[model samples]
Target: MSAEQDSVFVRNFALVIATLVGVTVLLIVIANSVFGDMDPERQALAEERAEQNLSPDFAVRLSGEPAPAIASADSGADEGGVTEVRSGEQVTQAVCIACHQGNFLNAPGIGDKAAWNERIGKGWETLTQNVADGYGNMPAQGGAASEEEIRAAIEWMVESETGLEVPES
Candidate 1:
């Protein structure tokens, strides 16, 4: 291209860049003028939302550190310092239902007599122990529920649902 044409092209390009920069600046100014004077209520709401969004969902604890106290809905304990034991149905619905309802990870489906029949043969003690320790794809439920709760869940999931009594060992 000729020098004149190159100069014209450069001038046009410069103009285009300058226009974009001016437009950007104008937009920023307009936005600040429109939103800078936020009402106290709106500003407070925005701040609250920001705090909620930025809050961490979980905490990390190193090994051997004392576990953080968990907030429970029912914090009342009995005279013996034992918290109220949840019923079979409650435990089964709350914990066992997650896996047992759908037979997830090859877990026996709730109310599946055929499946419970096989496990029922393993007897109550064995089945409860297996559940407490975790068997197959199931994780150790000992941490989630106490031994009494575990037994209740098994009774509910196996005996009540399947109509097959777990043989007491």
Candidate 2:
């Protein structure tokens, strides 16, 4: 192309870029004008949601350190501050159901007699110990529940649900 043609092309390109920049700035200004004043309640909710989203889902604890206290919706503590133990059904629903319901990670499904039979043969003590210390794809339940609660959950998930009693060793 000739020098004149190149200059004209360059000028046109600059004008196009300038127009695009102008349009972008105009849109930004219009958007700010339209949405600059957010509703107080909406703003509060947005901030809260952002905080929740940014919060860590899990925390790390060093070995030998005391385990973090588990939070319960219905603490059910008496005047003596001794928290009432949750029932087997409740513990099963809250903790075990996540994996057991769907048989996640090859976990035995709730009420699956065949699956329970295989593990039930392992007996209550063995099963409870396995559950307490992460077994297979399952994480340890010791942090989530007391030994009694773990036993109850096992009874509910294996015996009560499957109609197969776990052998007490």
Model 2 earns a TM-score of 0.53
Candidate-wise lDDT, in order = 0.84, 0.85
Shift of residue 85 alpha carbon in model 1, Å = 0.2
RMSD in Å for all candidates = 7.9, 10.0
TM-score of 1: 0.53
- Cα-lDDT of candidate 1: 0.84
What digit string (tens of lDDT, one per residue) describes model 1 on residues 73-145?
6656423334578999999888999988987998999889998887788887888898899888989999989
Candidate 2 lDDT over 1-169, as tens digits, reads: 8999999999999999999999999999999999999999999999998888776534454565554445556655534334678789999999999999998999999899998887788877888999999888999889998889999998888788878877778
Tell me how many clashing residue pairs each candidate has: 0, 0
